[model samples]
Every structure is written in C-alpha cells, then in structure tokens.
Target chain A: METTTLIPTGPPATRPRRSPARLVRAAAWIALAVLLAALPLYIDTAWLKAGQYMMIGAVGAIGLTLLTGQAGQLSLAHAFFLLVGATAYTVLAGPTDEERVIGLGLDPGLALMGAVLISALVGLAFAPVAGRLRGIYLGVASLSLVFLGLYFGQSLDSLTGGTSTGRTPATFELFGFPFSNGGPEIEVLGVPIRQAERIWYLFLVLTAIAFVLARGAVRGRVGRSWRAVRDNEAAATAMGVGVARAKAGAFAVSSAFAGLAGVMTVLWFDILKPDESEYGTYGINVSIAFLAMVIIGGLGSVPGAVVGALIVNGLPQALTLFSGDLGWFGETGGGGLTPILVSSFIYGAAIVVVVLFEPGGLAAIGRRLTGLFRARPREITREETS
Target chain B: MSAPTLREDLVELQVDSVTLAFGGLRALDDVSFTVEPGTVHALIGPNGAGKSSCFNVISGVYRATSGRVRFGDTELTGQRPHRLAKLGIGRAFQNTALSPHSTVLDNVMLGRHALTTGGFLSCGLRLPWTVRQERRHTERAVEICEFLGLGKVLHAPVAALSYGAAKRTDVARALAIEPTLLLLDEPAAGMNAVETAEMAATIRDLRDALGISILLVEHDMNLVMGIADRVTVLDFGKRIADGTPSEVQADPEVVKAYLGSGSEDA
Candidate 1:
C-alpha cells in the first residue's frame, strides 16, 4: 500500500460579523431568564407555585436533554427515579417516633441525601442493560422500569404508603430552622419573601447548577463523542470510543437529576404517593412531559431544554387558568381538560414541528436568528466595498 | 525505475493460514501473506478475490476461521476494532465514513478520542486541564485537516463537502490517530488527474513524516504501480504473485488475471 499523507493548508481565520438580530435574540433570552427568576415575586401565589413546578420540571428536562438530545438514547423510565427518591424521603423521614412501616428513622435532611444516593445507585444498576440496547430497544427497556416502579409502589405497602396515599412530615428543618409551611421570612429590597419563596430560591439554585453542568457537558469532549456515536456508531468504535459506557453514563446522569427532582417534589407537596394521577404522582405521563420539554427545547441544546420546559409546563397552566374563567366545560372539568388534553395535543404538535422543520429545536432557531442579524453588517460593508 | 530490494529481516505483519467462510461459500481459503513495514504493500485481485475480506480480518472487522495474525509480536486475530486501533491500526473504509452533519474539525477530533483520558464528567465539568487538552486536540485536528488541504472547510459541515473532499477528510481522520499501520481502501477511487496526483504526493508525505506502514488497495494499476514498494497479486482467494511493482506487473499469472492476453495495453 502506498501511504500518501496530504499536509493540510490551514484556512485563514475570519472574525464573525455582528448582527442586530442576534443581539435582539440574545437580549430576549437574557430578558426571559431574568423574568423567570423574578417571576415568583411578581406573580400571584397560585402562579408562583406553578412557576416553581415549571422550574423543577426544567431541571428534570435538562437531564433528559443529556440522555435523548446529546446521546440519542430514548428513556421512558425517568419517573421511576423520581418515585424512588420521593418514597425514599417519606419512608426515611416519616414520623421518627410513630409506629414505623419499613421506616429507617432517619432525619429529613439525611433522608433526602439517602434518597438521591439510592436513586443514583438504582440508575447505575439499570445502566448496563440500558446501554447495551440502542434506539427503540433502549426505549422499551427503560419503559419497563416505569412498570416495575409502579408495581412496587402499589404492591409494596410497607415501603410506599400503599394505594391509600400518605402525607410526608411537615417542617424539613435545616440548621435548626423549619422549611415547610411558611417557616422563615426574609426581607429582600423591603419585600418580605415567604417560606415558599425561600423554597423556590432553593429549587432555582439547583436548576441553575443543572443548566451550567449540562451546558458544559454538551460543549465538551464527551458531548462530541456522543454526537459521533449517535451519528455513526461504527466510526465512533473505530475512533476507540467506548460506545456502551458513554450511553450508560448518559442514562445515569439523567436519572440522577430525576431523583433530585423527586426529592424536591416531596418537599414541595409534603406527600409521596404513587397511586395518584399523572399530575399528582411521578408516573409515565410525567416522563412524557419531560420528553416533550426536551423535544420542544431542542434535542441537543442545553438552553433549549429550559425553553422547552417553560413552554410545555407554562402553556398548560396558563390554559387551565383561562379555561376556569371561561367555564368552557363544567366548573370541575374545565381546568383538568384544558391542561391535560389541550396541552398534550399542543405538546405533540410542537414535537412534530420540531422534528420536521427545526430539528435543532428552539436553540437552532435562536442561533439562526442570531446569525441572520450578525451577517447584516458584513453584507452592507461588502456591498459598499464592491 | 530502480527495483528497491526487499529487506531480508523486515518486521512484517504476518497472516498465517487465515480462512473466512460465510455459510457455504468460502470468502478466503487458507489465505496467507506478509506486509513489510516502512513500505507500501498493495493487495490487488479481481472481483470476489477476498482482498476486502483480508483487509477486514487484519483490521479486526472480521475474525478468521482458523489463522493467526501477528503485528510484530502481538496476536490481533480476534481483537475488537477499538482495541486494534489502540494497538496502532487505523483503517479508512472504501465508502466515505465521515459524519455528514458534523464540522470537519469535529470529525477529525474523533480520531484523537483514544488518546484523550477524561471521561464524561471531566469533560462536562470543563476541568481546567480538560479544556486545555481540548484546545490541543482541536489544534492537532486543524493541523491534520490543513495537511489534507481541508483547512478551508474546517468549520464547514461534512454534508456540504464534495465527494473528493469527503474522501480526503476520512484519510485525515484516520491519520489523526497517528497509527503504526495505515489501511487505505482505494483512496484515489474517484479523484481526477489533479486530485490523484495530489493524493499520491500526500501518501508519500505520510510515510516520510509519520514513518507508518501502509496497506493500499486500489484498482488503478497505474497509480498503484507508481507508488507501491511491493505488490501482492491475488486471484480466486489465493496469492498468485508477490514482488516489487514491476516484477508483479510482469508475472504471467498477474498478466493473465488482470491484463488479459498479455497485451501491450497492460
């Protein structure tokens, strides 16, 4: 074999031109993030609670972004991790003095830590099988986890509170201060923030951390390997990437986030019940909701995950509020139908739009808009020079 | 052209008694050959001659039914592709295997994956050292891409590249690994005269600069004869002749199998 090696001539680096449109879009994103952070203070108590839910949902969605978006692995068992964490919290921290049902008699803070650790361990257990399977096979394997979780949640009465449902203990005290039900008030800029606001801030901090970590992952070497595997597995193998390990690691990371969300969910609601409906329980529907968030945001974009979570979560809440005032259906039926059915249809429709037209999701749209605006000045300058 | 004498004690890759059978049909029948290092080795034959099968076996894409493949002292018969890669064996497919959606830089960086150590968490966290490593890898990929005259399209998506450019990108990606043994499956199959000459020069440069052994599989006899140090001719899954380019080109069996009727046109 004659070995021919071509010396590559380096292309001259050119500075990217600035665009007003890109500036506007970036400003829009900054404005949105700022608005979201400040939203709790400006909104009503109901909407503030809903905003908190959306932020939590965004955190879970960011994890899904890593799994499905970057790694190109589909998972439908995210709710299983959520359930595990929530139940672990209740079981571990439930009334230390009461007649315990499979209770470990651990403190709430310790229980939360234990919940996260246990969920992470369980995620690792499923990683091997999940990693071995690809595309639809992986999807089916992960979906099975949800069924397994549901079975235990319903049948394991000692561990779970059973089908009857159970309340979590009030006052998850940290540093000798209560965090549940209007515990401590903090005055911020002459505005007194309630216990819920404090909890919201905690969730926000976690969400921010998740976003930064996910962003770094997507932009780094690991992210590149994932894209390579997703694009061409054979080539990736040829490049000496451990395809199975990369896929499995993505699943574990995604599951860890779900577990964290579960802990927060229990703290927010003061309950852990598996038999409750999709909205109430961390079930299959919640998994779908998370998937929708990723798809709408942009499959591989970190920022897209947050955008998607807000769209998918916020739209339904807004619609329900609208439906309640309009009285479209019966008083009791209107709120549920609008959020569940209509929001689902919208979610489904948004996914189709994303897949067909803008596969990059909201992130791609943002990039394009930026590029368009950035190129304007260059175009004008060229025209003038010519 | 002067006949370059073969080194009597060259540390060649030896394939001994390798047989590959697919169901009832045998693709390779007790095939055996030696590829000398620091020289171009050509594996050429008619269609269904098991040339590709031999390439596949040596590159760890296919396992031999009964044989031993030794690269220096290591047995590479049943190793996985990645393991083989780690052992310094790099392969470029006949079909361009570049990721169409990724940038040229990203595609080449895939080659350096084996060299990098940080796992998912390290990369995700953007550890100071990992970022520095990434910059160095990107620089290397750029250097390799520029070497292949693909620097102009470094940031461009592979999907936007022409067939010839894409093929060159594959070679660059394989070379980025800095392999001890490089396998090129018809690297000049679809290039024009200018591109072919450029490719030939690039191939020679690779050997001189990298000091890696090369295995070239090509149908273009003129191009093969121009650069190959030693050519092994195969017919019906058996080695018909093996010698210096001119010697193999003049062999009666090679003439009968490849250039019918021993014509002057050959």
Candidate 2:
C-alpha cells in the first residue's frame, strides 16, 4: 500500500472551503448511491446477487487497502481472517439445541459483531510476527495463518462443521426484523421484495458503513501516520508515531473488515462449508484475488479499492448469470477456461499494465480527470533562488 | 521554568562515553560529548568520520555497543526515535525523509505527532475532540511553515516542490515537533550561497528567538564558523578538537585533518 496519494492538496484544516470541483465530486457520489438504490427494482435476483457479491468484495478490499495499501504492510492473510470471521459467526449463532456442533446460541446481531471482534483479535495476535517481518517475509508469514485456518477448519468440526457436511448459519436478524423471506412480507412501490432483495439492502448498508469509515481513516491524522510509516519508518518514529503499533493496528482493522465480509459471505451462501482444497474458497488464491483488487484500485485509494473489487469480483458473478444463456463455457471446460480463469487472466493483465504504465493505478487516472475541473490548475511551483 | 546561565541551561544532552562496533570494525570509539542547552554546537569532520554514526546513536536509530545517553535526567540509551521526539529532540535528515506524495503541510503536520495526542479511533471516526486536536496541530504546523517562508506552497505535494523548497519544508517539519534541541545534518549541503545564508539566519533565529539549542553537522566551514558557539571536530570517530569556532578553526590538528592545512593562511 502507498500512503503518498492520501495527502489532501487543499488547505485550511478547520473547514475546507467548498469549491465547484468538490460539489461535482459530491454530486457524482450521490448519483452512484441513487443508482445502487434503484438497481434491485430493474434487475432480477441473479443480477442482484452478482451486485451483492461485488459489494462483499468492496468491503474486504477496503480493509485490505488500509493494511496493504495505506499502512504498507504486505498481507496474504485476508482469507484466513475471513475464515475466522465465518467460523466465529457460525459457532456463536448456531442453535443451542444443535446436536453435532458447538453453539453459543447468541443473538445473530451480536454474533455478527463478535465475528469481527474475534477475527480482529486473531489478527492482532499474529501482529507480533507480522510487525517483526517486512515485505515478502511478512507475506510468507501471513500465508502460514491461512494454512493454520485451513487446519482449524478441517479439525475443529465443532466450530466450522467439518469440510464435507458444513453447517448452515442462523439467519441474521436485527432486533425483531429478520433479514430473510421469513420476516414480515414487504413490497417496494409494487415490486415484490424477497430474501435476495432484503439481503442486498443489508449488504448495502454494511458496504456503505465500511466505505465511509475507511474514507474517514484515509483522510485523518491516523492516515498521516500510516503513510509516514509506509514511506519511511525512521521518519515516522521520529515524528512520534509508534511504527509497530501502527502496523499491528492496520492488520487488526483490516481483519475486522474481512471478518465482516466473512459474515456477509455466510449470509449470502446460506452454508458454511470449509473448502477441502487450498485452491478453493478460503485459500491462498482467494487471498491473491483480494490483493489483486487493492493493486488494481491503486493501493491506498479508498474509492479505487471499491472499483478494483467491482472489476475483479463482479466479472465472475456476471459470467454466472450468463451461464445458462451462454453454452460457450462447455467447449472450453477441457482447456480449463472457466469464468474464474478468464477473470484471473484479465486481472493478471490489469496488474501488469498498472505496474508497467500508471503506477498509481486507476486512482491516478481519476485524480487527473478531476484535476481538469479545478478552478486553478494547481500553481506550477518554481524554485525562485535569490 | 528556571532562568538560563550564560554557559548553561537547565537540561543538557549528555552523550557519555559511547562505542559502536560492527564485528571487528569500530564505528565509534569512546565518543563523549554534550550539547549544552540554548547554544549552537557544531560537530564537523571530513566525510565518513562517524558524524552521521553519532547522529544515529543520539536519535536512537543505532544502538551503541557500550554507552549511556541522557536527555537531562532521563536515560535515553535504548529509547526509540518516537520517544526521543516526545522528549523534545528533533532531527532533520540530510536527504530529507519526507513523504514525497503528500502535501507540504501534511509532511509538516507529521512533525506535530509528538505534541498532539489523537489516536486511531478518534481520528478514524472523525470525532469532534480529534478534529479539534488535529486543527490545533495543523495550526502549529502552519506557523512553522510561515516562519520558514514555506507558506506559499503548503498545498503542493513535496514531489512537485523544488529542492530548496523541499529542504526548507524538512526544516519546518522538524521545527513543527517543537523540540528543545534541533539536530541538523548537512542542512545546507546542496544549497546556493543565498539559500545557505538564509539557512544560517534561520538557525540563528531559532537559537535567539525560540531559544532552541542546535547540534549542527555540516562540512560547510563558513556556515559552521559563522553560526556555532562551540565546535567539536572528529577524526576517525575520535574527538580531535572541542572549543569555540575560532579556537577549533585555528587548531593545527583540526586544519590538518579537515580544512587541509593551509587555505586561510596561504
């Protein structure tokens, strides 16, 4: 993750004076929100599911961006934390009467929150090692956690419900209202809203909250220290920013976000099966995919991460929607040209292009486009040696 | 606060007999010195004479093999660089370790980290208290920038700034820490004559107006001799001369080792 891009070029810390450009940006954001709100009405459940999946990607990518992009800590442990969150959610929310698995039988809402907290604590525990290691060393060390999670999921059947006959999570409910078809039937402007529609709203809210909080962190004093630490550890320490704590905190925060994504994943799938193979769902490839989102998004840009997630995660969902309509996949099944494979190839190319050409990724492009609309195209500074 | 004496202040940076070794090679050998408060103390030597190594030891970047450092009454031998900042020791690196992608103001704001106390939660949530704290720190950074004549490009990313501007920004950043003592390493190394004069003036003002003690490490004899109250010369990590600027300048040994024996006399 790079911290250099988060610097706000605007001055006056008390209140940034409003400009036409900022208004345009705000208006664009509002338009995006409106479009997201209206999508369920026009699009069927399958498309909505695809959209929901990308939102999940957005949530997880935001967290990764904070850790890997902003804090400059290379982490391949997002998948491990995701599994931890999912397992924690399942174990805590499973019914007390369930015979085969361990269950706390807690409130679904509390269980959801507990999942985030538990995963974050686990990440924090790993931080001592994470903090000590740098670059690929940290990445390899974090990779060990994914393997650890794999073992835990396989052996600890009481918590994760084993690899084969995975348990179903209790449907999440906020207070008396269940976020399911079982809840009181509701309609929106003559449109019949079902489980898929309801879950989309829940995910929407979670994604929005995640995005807002991340944006806040990126623009604040904490963000400054993260960038400082990323750019130069000595400089950061000299400025009184505890480098280790900041690194650890970045991991914890990112894990918490991934944990939320895990909870969302369980709710979406309606099942909690641990992947039997390392190449499957909760595996190293999943971690790589998440990292691809951050890199394509331009490391530390909060909004860029979301766009990266959309490109990486949204493609497969769209392919799934086209599966029935398009029988072209059957021909390439022998050649291993699955939707995921194709998406991987595309994103792989994206990463290479991003690195080779625009190192800032999509965020730099976005900045330049926005810069064009500025009132005074930032004064080209001169040395003026006298 | 107690009043300062002509030769002394309440606190002094005591660098007790310190030695640093990398296997068989000794980087520093029983080096001892003190930066007296409210005075300009210059540490000068030829390149690779362990002046930077001394700075690394003082700022806690490098652990000394056998030595004890004290910031007034506090033991600072094993203290972290961040902890040193809290203890009122500011340092400006020769290469200027600034976040080049960030704005000039943001880089300066980093220097205010020790003086301000807002954690991740408050800042991440944009809490009212944190906003207030952040504003106060920014205000102080702004003042530092203005004092250094770097107010014009506060919003410019450091990467976009000229070398002189960036150098000034680095110094302003150090000052933003509000240190009782400032350690400057080759601050005017690449500067033109005018910029060097400006830098010398700033160092003088810092000692005079802000009453901040300075430990200057520079190869520029003119700047060192003009501004220093006391000069300490090093030869191969061992202290060769420690005296007033004129006394050290006149010393035959100091000239032989550093000033090359006869520039002024010839």
For every candidate, what share of the true interface contacts is present? 0.52, 0.55
In model 2 chain A, the worst 10-residue window by lDDT is A1-10
Which window of 10 residues has the lowest lDDT sum in candidate 1 chain A? Answer: A1-10
Per-chain TM-score of chain B, candidate 2?
Answer: 0.92
Provide backbone clash counts, one per model.
18, 2
TM values, all candidates? 0.87, 0.92
Model 2, stretches more than 4 Å misplaced?
Answer: A1-15, A323-327, A331-337, A379-386, B1-10, B192-194, B259-266
Residue B83 local lDDT, model 2: 94
- For every candidate, how close is chain A to the native chain A in TM-score? 0.83, 0.93
Write model 1 residue lDDT over A139-213, tens digit each, in one string: 888988888888888888777767685655435666656664565666666656776766777778778877878
DockQ of candidate 2 (2 decimals)? 0.44
**Where is model 1 more than 4 Å wrong at Cα?**
A1-37, A89-98, A105-114, A167-178, A181-184, A276-280, A322-330, A334-337, A376-386, B1-12, B189-194, B259-266
